[model samples]
Target: MVTPDLTTSVAGIDFKNPILTASGTFGYGLEFTDFLDLNRLGGLVTKGLSAKPRKGNPPARVVETPAGMLNAIGLQNIGVPVFLEEKLPKLRAYDTKVIANVFGATEVAYVEACEMLGEAEGVAGIELNVSCPNTEEGGMIFGTDPAALGHVIRICREATKLPLIVKLSPNVTDIQLMARCARDAGADAISLVNTFVGMAIDVERRRPVLANVCGGLSGPAIRPLAVWMTWQVHQAVEIPIIGIGGIMNARDVVEFLLAGASAVQVGTASFVTPSASANIVTELEDWLSERKITSVRELIGGLELPPRG
Candidate 1:
C-alpha cells in the first residue's frame, strides 16, 4: 500500500499531520523527547504562558474520574520571557511546528504575552487560552463572554503578526457564538471546547476532591460533546477549527476531522501514554492507507448528515 498523505494546514501553518500535543499536558515539548521523536509528530503546543510566572494552585490538583481526569493546574508556567529565552531555543532543533499557548489574567496581559511570543524565533503561531479570567472585568472569563472574547482577540491581533488561534471554553450557552466572535475579532483559527468545568466530591469526607474546588474535565468522557460542538462551530464560522478534547487514538482523530476540524490536539491522553500522540500519527497513516484514502484532509467535515424533513 502507498503511503497516505497526512499533511494538513491550519491558520496557514502546515503540519506534517493533524496530530498536535495539547498545551499543559506536553510540558513545553521537551520533556517528551525520550518518549517520542518530536519530529515524527505534526506540532506541539507549549504550556499556557503568561506575562509573569505562576505558582499554580495548591496540592490535590488532579483526580481520576470515570473515563477521564480533572485538573486544576491554574495555568501554571515559567512565563513567556523565560520560555523564549530558554525552552524555545532547544525546540528549534525539532522539525515540527511549535505553537505557543498563551493566557493572561487580564486583556493587557494577554496582549503582552502575545507580543513576546510573536517576536520570538522558531515559534509557529499563538494559541490564546482565553479560558482565563479577566481580572479587569470582575473575574469574568474571556472565553465565556463574546464581547470579552472579541475584545481580547482584537487587541492580541494588533499585538502580533503571528497567526492567532482562540481556544474557546465549553462552559457557555452557545459555543458557536463564541467561535464567531473570535473569528470576527481577527482570529486566524479557533480551537474548541477547552475544558468543561466540573467538580468531584470525596463523598466519604464530604469535601471537594480538587484543592481548587473545581477543575477542567478531559478525556473520552468529553469526546462526544467536543465532536458535536466542533460540527456546530464548523457550520457557524468559515475559519479553520482545531478540534481539542479527549482524543485517544487514530479513530478519535478521524471523528474530529469528520466533524469539521482541520486538525486535532492530543490532551489528556498524553498523561496516560507519553507516546500517544506520536503513536496516533503512525496509526492514522495506516488507517487511511487501509481504506484507500489519498489524503487525510479528505476527512475534514466529511460527516454525512441525515436529511431533515
Candidate 2:
C-alpha cells in the first residue's frame, strides 16, 4: 500500500503536511500539548506579537454568533523578547514548524519585529500581520492600501531572511491588487482572508454586544468567502497562499486547496475543539486514501470551473 504523501513546501520552507494552525488561533503552539501531539501536525503559527506586550481589549471581547464568532482580542500577546526568552525554547522542542506572526502600529515597528523574529533560532518563518492600522498613515491598515502594504513588506523583507508570509485583510476592495503588491514587495507567500469586520447588537440592552463594538468574524460562516478570495488571489499571483477563514474540517481544507491554496490554516475550529487541527490532519490523509489519491499536492488548483454561457 502506498502512503499518501502530504508534504508541501511553501515559500521555501517544507511542511510535513498542508494543514497548519492559523495565527491567533493556536495560541503559542504549546497550549495544546495536553490535547494532541504537536509533532503530528504540519506547522503552527503563533499568536500575533509586538515589540511590547499588550493588554488587549476590555472584557466581552468575544461573542458567539449563529454560524460563527466575533472577537476583538486586540492582538494581545507577550511581546517578542518574552517569546524568544520563554516561549521559543519550549516551542523548539516540538518537531513541527513554528512560524511567528508579527504585527505593529507602524512600518518601522513591523520591520523591527521582523528583524527580531528573523534572528530567533526556533522560528521556521515570519508571517507579517499587515491587518493592523498604519498609525503613521493616519490610521489606515497597511493591507488596505497597496502602496502602503508594499512599503511595509519591502522594509520587512530587508529586515528578515526568514520566509515572509503576508496575511491580507478582506476589508479591502480588491484582494488581488493587494496580493500582487505583496508579491512585488518580495513577499514569499500570502495568507488570507483575515477575519471580516463585523458587529452584533443587543437589542434588549440597546448596546453593542462586544466591548470593542466591531470585531473580526470567523468560523463556518466565512468559508465560502474565503474560498472565493483564495481563488481570486490564486489567479492573480504565483506566490504560495495559505488559505484561512472558516476551515472547520477536512473537506474545508480540500476546498481551499482545490481553489489553489498551497496550504490551509485552521482557525476558529480550534476554538470549538482544541484537537481540531490534529484531527483534520489525520482526516485529510484518510480522505485522500479513500479517494485513491497518492499525494495531497495533486489537489492544488484542481477545481474545474463550468464553461461560460
Tens-place lDDT digits, model 2, residues 68-181: 998888888899989999999998898999999988878788777887776678899998888742122211378888888999899999999999999998889899999999
lDDT of 2: 0.88
Off by over 4 Å in 2: 132-140
lDDT of candidate model 1 versus the reference: 0.89
**Model 1 C-alpha lDDT per residue in residues 204-244, reported as the tens digit of each score:** 99999998888888999999999999999999999999999
- Clashing residue pairs, backbone N/CA/C < 3 A, model 1: none
For residue 172, give model 2's deviation from the true position in Å: 0.9
Superposed by TM-score, candidate 1 places the C-alpha of residue 279 at a distance from the truth, in angstroms, of: 0.1
**After superposition, which runs of candidate 1 have C-alpha atoms over 4 Å from their true positions?**
132-140
Write down the TM-score for model 1.
Answer: 0.97
lDDT of 2 at 51: 79
lDDT (Cα, 0-100) at 289 in candidate 2: 92
**TM-score for each of the candidates:** 0.97, 0.97
